[model samples]
Target: MFRTAVGAVGLLAALAAVPPASAESNSDYSVLIISRERLEVATSCEIGVYLNDQLSGRVFQEQSTSFNLPPGPVDVRLRLLPGQMPGCAAGIEDQRSTRLNLQAGQINKYRIAMGHNGLELRRASLGY
Candidate 1:
């Protein structure tokens, strides 16, 4: 019984030497998706998606793309680019810098749709 007590105390001491988990170690991330809600009128151009004024990706009609980003505020922009489709023309540009307020291990969705002024980036509800 005395040997058992000493071994248990030694094990406890070793465990206490280890550092505790930190909040930063969690490294939470957010998932963002840009979905083309519908085809543009008189145009078949692929829209350019920009993150923080840098070109990220392009989305075509009925297509979608996703990004895994750190949880925080992000700047997103969208613009219609010239495409191979005949009669397609560049439309107005859209941009927005919004805070997602995302939580750890959560996903955020956005819909890319055309508004009266130009392209739009709106938050969309998750299906699942």
Candidate 2:
């Protein structure tokens, strides 16, 4: 009994030394943008996605953009990067942030629209 107790205590101590899961944990996500107006050149525009205020990836008018992240809730924001923002990004506001509760093996999609007034003038979410 004494040896068993000592081994159990030692095992518990080692386990407790491990780091806890972070709330900032997240998972990979696939993003798609469709121009509600009309289909533009594949590489004529730039799209950027930000997770928890950090830049995750960018898309240059791709049909879809995918990114991998750690697992939890993430604030996904899409914006126009560099030369893709001739309509805005200078003064006019153009960006959208979507909150997603993510888990491993889960998928999410975000749709943003580009307008003459701003990037992502509108947003639509499909599927959980």
Candidate 3:
């Protein structure tokens, strides 16, 4: 009985030393914040946000979205999504993508704006 108790205690101690499998850490990821709060674009269309060519999220006027991406280069493409608005049809705007190098534990912000060419992302400050 004493030997079984000792073994159980040893097993309990070993289990306590190991980290829980569900205890995930976000330190390896970076945050990307895209905001459309500025009136520079002046459009009622919802903007489609693509990560590596995959449609991830959407943002409208005075709105924003954030993504937790892994550390590396991410291809961010912005396009006006077809919606209820008459002028929000697809293929009405440029489809250029911007490549951003994201670092771990860093937060990068950008504001959608209408550049000379078309819709583009401009580096923005931390707050709106």
Which candidate leads in TM-score?
Answer: 3
* Per-prediction tally of clashes: 0, 3, 0
Pairing residues by index, what is the TM-score of model 2?
A: 0.48
RMSD in order of candidates: 7.5, 8.1, 3.8
Candidate 3 residue-wise lDDT, 1-87, digit = tens: 999999999999999999887844777899999999989887899999999999999999999999999999999999889999998
Each model's TM-score, in the order given?
A: 0.65, 0.48, 0.80
User: What are the runs in model 2 whose C-alpha is more than 4 Å off?
Assistant: 1-43, 84-89, 94-96, 114-128
Pick the winner on TM-score between candidates 1 and 3.
Answer: 3
Instruction: List, residue by residue over 9-115, the lDDT tens digit for candidate 2.
Output: 99999999999876533334433333323344333556666778888776654456555544577776666566635653434354556667666655545555545
Error of 2 at 47 (Å): 1.5
Judging by lDDT, tell me the better candidate of 2 and 3: 3
Model 1 Cα lDDT, one tens digit per residue, 1-128: 99999999999999999999866544477788888755543346777888888889998878889998888778887887777876457644445544456665677788876667677777888878
lDDT of 1: 0.75
**Which runs in model 1 stand beyond 4 Å of their true positions?**
1-27, 37-42, 87-101
The TM-score-based order of candidates, best leading, equals 3, 1, 2
- lDDT: the better of candidates 1 and 3: 3
Task: Rate residue 112 of model 3 by lDDT.
Answer: 95
Q: What is the lDDT of residue 23 in candidate 3?
A: 46
